[model samples]
Target: MEEVYEFLKNAKTWYLATVDEEGNPQVRPFGAQNIFEGKLYIQTGLKKKVAKQMLSHPRIAITGMYQGKWIRLNADAIYDARIEAQQSMLDANPGLKHMYQAGDGNTAVFYLKNAVAEICSFTEAPEIIRF
Candidate 1:
């Protein structure tokens, strides 16, 4: 989890890579990545494109990259079951509330379960392990 934490904090933003049922890969840039209670959450609305895509295909990849340096994460996503976590994230980031809030009164928040992160230092070619 520490590596995951480092990966999240060090990278400016994660590029979320998702695949449609027909195998079309959809990649989007997301800015809010808050870790709470040992879980990483990406908040957004259910009706949004990514949310709808996740509902159909829960498997996704999130990657953080810079100047050939990167961390590729394999994760399983689920529509968050708890509102407290979502609210907590909103509380932490007051500015993004509008982005997370859908006009119809839906909160967009989801958890990426057990993100197994692979940190790769491209300049070195071989990856190093650190916790």
Candidate 2:
């Protein structure tokens, strides 16, 4: 999980994929990521379609690239509504304060569970980590 978090944090921006109501894939760029209690967390808003889709289907895939290497993380995003979780995410990403406040009714956070992460590079063999 730390490796996954490091890759995402270093990349700064990653694309998350969720399945919509009709089973179509929805992909969007996300910039906030943090690790709390040995888990990787991502933030979103309850009012957003991505959150809704995630609630219905917990499986998600995230991809990002940094320094000619790429990472792919697939996990079951379990919702973590605890205030501490929200605070942890906000604290890790101060810039998010502009869009969301800790404990706000609209703010939602999910931690990646049962995660499989792959680090790949054209010049090196792939490394796979599961947590």
Candidate 3:
């Protein structure tokens, strides 16, 4: 879990994939990430299409490249309605405060559950991490 978090945090920008109602895949670049209470959390606006897609389909994939290695993660995105979760994310990413506030109703935070991440590089065998 720590390795996965480090990879993502260092990557700065990771892509999140979710399935829409039509069953098509939607991919978007995301930069907000944090770990709270041993859970990896991501932030987005509740009004965004990505949030809607995630709500309808909790299963998702995320990938990011850092240095010469990349990480692919599959997990269930469980929405956390608690203000503390939202606030924690906002605190981690202070820039987000300009666009969202805790309990603002538009802020949405989700903790990844049952996550399996593979860190791969052409020069080495893949390293797997599960949390």
Candidate 4:
């Protein structure tokens, strides 16, 4: 869990690769994830195309690098908008305070599917590692 937070915090930007209903890949860069109690929190516009994509195919991939060659992870994204959507985002980034108003309009969250973190590195061999 601590490792998860560290990786997410260090990531300047993450590539969210999702597949459309037609199985076409749509990759985009986004930065709005917060780590809470060993969980990763991500938010975005509900009207956005990614949101639509999630509805069709909830599976996703999130990746980042750590030590130039130590591939940080390949996460299984689980789109979750219910259960702590608003508070979790604010707690994670805190910048959302300025983005929010008297009413929380941008209140949506995505949970990592299966939510497994693997340390991907090709130092010597091919071993599937999970952190």
Distance from true location, Cα of 48 in model 1, Å: 0.9
Write down the TM-score for model 3.
0.99
- After superposition on all C-alphas, the RMSD of every candidate to the true structure, in Å, is 3.1, 0.7, 0.5, 3.2
lDDT of 1 by residue, 44-113 (tens): 6666788888878888888887656788877777777577777777876677776664333567667778
Which of the two candidates, 2 or 4, achieves a greater TM-score against the reference?
Answer: 2
Best-fitting candidate, scored by TM-score: 3
Best-to-worst ranking by lDDT: 3, 2, 1, 4
Model 3 regions lying over 4 Å from their true place? none
Between 1 and 4, whose lDDT is larger?
Answer: 1
Better of 1 and 3 by TM-score: 3
lDDT of 3 by residue, 95-129 (tens): 99999999999999999999999999999999999
Highest lDDT model number: 3
Predicted candidate 2: what Cα RMSD to the true structure? 0.7
Q: Candidate 3's error at 9, in angstroms?
A: 0.9
TM per candidate comes to 0.79, 0.98, 0.99, 0.73
Clash count for candidate 1 is 2
lDDT of 2 by residue, 1-131 (tens): 78888889899999999999999999999999998887889999989999999999999999999999999889999999898999999999999999998788888999998999999999999999999
